[model samples]
Target: MTTAAMRVPVTRGYRFEWVKLVSQWRIRLVVLACWVAPALFVAGVSQQATLPVDTLFGRWMHATAWAGPLVLLGFAGQWALPLLTSLVAGDVFAAEDRLGTWRHLLVAVRSPRRIFVAKALASLTVILLMVTGLFVSSTAGGLLAVGDRPLVGLDGHLLATGDAAGRVALAWLCALAPTLALAGIGLLGSVALGRSPMGLLLPAVFALAIELAQMLPLPVAVRLALPGYNWNGLFTSPMQLRSVLISVVAGLIWALTATALAYLIFVRRDFTNLNHDGSARRAVLAGALPLIALGAATVVVLAVAGLGAGSGIGQDKVQRSLATAFAHLYRVQTGQLNRPDVTEAQLGASAACTRGGGQTDPEGPGNDWRCVVSWRLPDTTAVGSAIYQLDITPDGRFVADGDGPKEVNGYFLVRTPAGDAPNPLWQFDGTVELLPKG
Candidate 1:
């Protein structure tokens, strides 16, 4: 055979397989799901009332972070992406066996290796296209719904607008690492099953099993073996580039190993009895073992770290400090000291303080008293001390305080008891009111 004629058959095989895989509707659906799911999730979060304006983008970003990578993983992970990838990959070899066309194609093309390469390339192309589509669609949807606002970080600090966008993009890219490893697994399953279903179903089942195993208590070394945990480097803010690099290296190793295993099995296995019943069961067990062990170890390490960290100091502290600051401000402005004998209603309405001596009025019946109030509320805990001035009116109808002449003046209009006439003496700014002793 001339070298030119030899090249023709190989070139034709590549084109034929490429067209077949690309035209498959299953690959199209996975791509669609990737875009649609994140868009819907972001839209739903936008309509929620309780999510603060500042956090809307941050929360939405997290929801869709896994969408792009997981779409790729679905092909490689064994269930969703694997199933999709397998629609073409699994059937690449199996379809030939099922149709009794394997021997004929091998004879026609005269090279099983070329056919395998073509199919692998097609499957990978589809995976990459779907991943790209997902990233673009989800990022656009999230940005549209939430607006291009700066995101609030986990620590209650705000991330700069450009930095937040960059971090979000990095997160999506990080998620892609696991999917690459999953693709290799899918290829292995494709070769092993000699049928699409086994190749597709086993990878998915393995992914789930790994996820479940990671939930178990285990050591860090074991946990690192699971593909899902390795992708977490993508979500780490401030960009843990070192961790991401490590995950990439690990993922590449998994891909290479799975690909080698698939090649060996395909090159050696007999396709004559492709309908063999036990093959499916064998494939399931083979995929499950390593995945589950790795997952369990990952879960254990995470749980131990979480428990050791202790219960997190929550948002309650922030609220408490703000409340305390307001409480102290109120106490300084009013001379009424908080007393156990005071009614709950009175206590709630009054700012209590201890009386301190000040300028006295000898010409009138009433006395002038100076006072100080010290109280702490949770929000104001950061502010150690606060003080305010108070002045009781001559007839005891009002109390007034100001930092300077009319500069920071305020009054509490005293509400008189029921059936009692209004008293100018008790009247003050918005806060103070005299109730008859009960």
Candidate 2:
């Protein structure tokens, strides 16, 4: 008797794997966790807005309007994503050994390549679902709690409401790129370290280690290669396209290399000896330690460089400029010069004249004159204080003294004929430059 020809199409393998994966309860649990966690976090933030305290936290929360959603993505990528991917990817080959079904499957399906492709596709689908769920949940929560108001950036600049929302969306999308790299690494780990906790925990640990290393003050070249840099654009006001592009390229390299290595090892290794073997433990640690060390060293070098840079002169200049500019602008906007009171004695013994409000000037064009201004709060609970000085230049221009921390020095263009209807002498116009020490 001749047996009927038996032919199982290659496409059937993927369908079979997907059907098996969807039937598993583990995937459902992970999907639920990804969706629920961010929803609850958003609810908690909304409740916190009603508390009676300083608005510092409130302001910070408003600024980071997209943080909750992004953080949910980060958290899942760190642990949950890896663990879930491993459920299918890790067990792809090993489960056959555990169930003593590998030989049977080998005989029945007659193709290991088809089985591998099917399982990989199934894992990829789950990751896509989780990422989508995180983005939707986060956007909903942020809008509900924060309102669609304009965003105030960390630098104190304002962003229009529409621009802020668009940037936020871009930021979320940028964050996902690194997450995909992480998922690829997890897939590699699951396949290589089959049926062991190392398959699950090692990738998560590696991701955290990379993050810590990037925090160090390393060379710009090395930092560009690390995955952590991929998210830096998210924090920048107008996203730095160059930096983001470099990070994306580096992530792609790492993902491809890792996946290739995992596939090479899994396809060649014998799975029949699957048992509690110390050899597998050694292999896992031996492979992971060097990468961890490299990441750690990068962090240390970068951190030291950052500390050596001191308090950052550019930042200091920006802050002082902003403070001075805002003060003057507010005065201009309000149309009032509310000078505080200073005593004649506080102006120094060389004072030529003293006004009731503590304003003072020295006798000659070359003298250094100092004045102190003080005012009591209406409630009498606190007192406001300031000091101003005048330095007479050889050019006959009365330069307002700003050499000391208490003084703001600048050239004052006084009116030649003193007080008039629109007192020209009383009008002060020129740049108010802060001294280096101040």
Winning candidate number (TM-score):
2
Candidate 2: clashing pairs of residues: 216-302, 216-303, 217-302, 217-303, 218-302, 342-358, 402-409, 415-425
Encode model 2's per-residue lDDT on 79-158: one tens digit a residue: 55545545545455445545566556655666555556666677666767776777777667767776666553322234
lDDT of each: 0.46, 0.48
Model 2 regions more than 4 Å off? 1-11, 50-67, 71-97, 235-237, 271-438
* Span of 10 residues, lowest total lDDT, candidate 1: 429-438
For model 1, the superposed segments whose C-alpha errors exceed 4 Å read 2-12, 35-37, 50-91, 155-157, 229-237, 271-438
lDDT of 1 by residue, 1-438 (tens): 864456435567778877876676865676777667756655555556433222212222332332222233222333445445445455566666566677666666656667677767767777777766666765666666656665533221235667666765665565566666677777777777755566665556656766676445433334344565333223223333543454565556666666666665665555456464226554555544544554455446545544212111112322222223234334322323222232222323222332334334212112233222233434334322322343332111113233222211223232233332212112122111111111
Model number with the top lDDT? 2
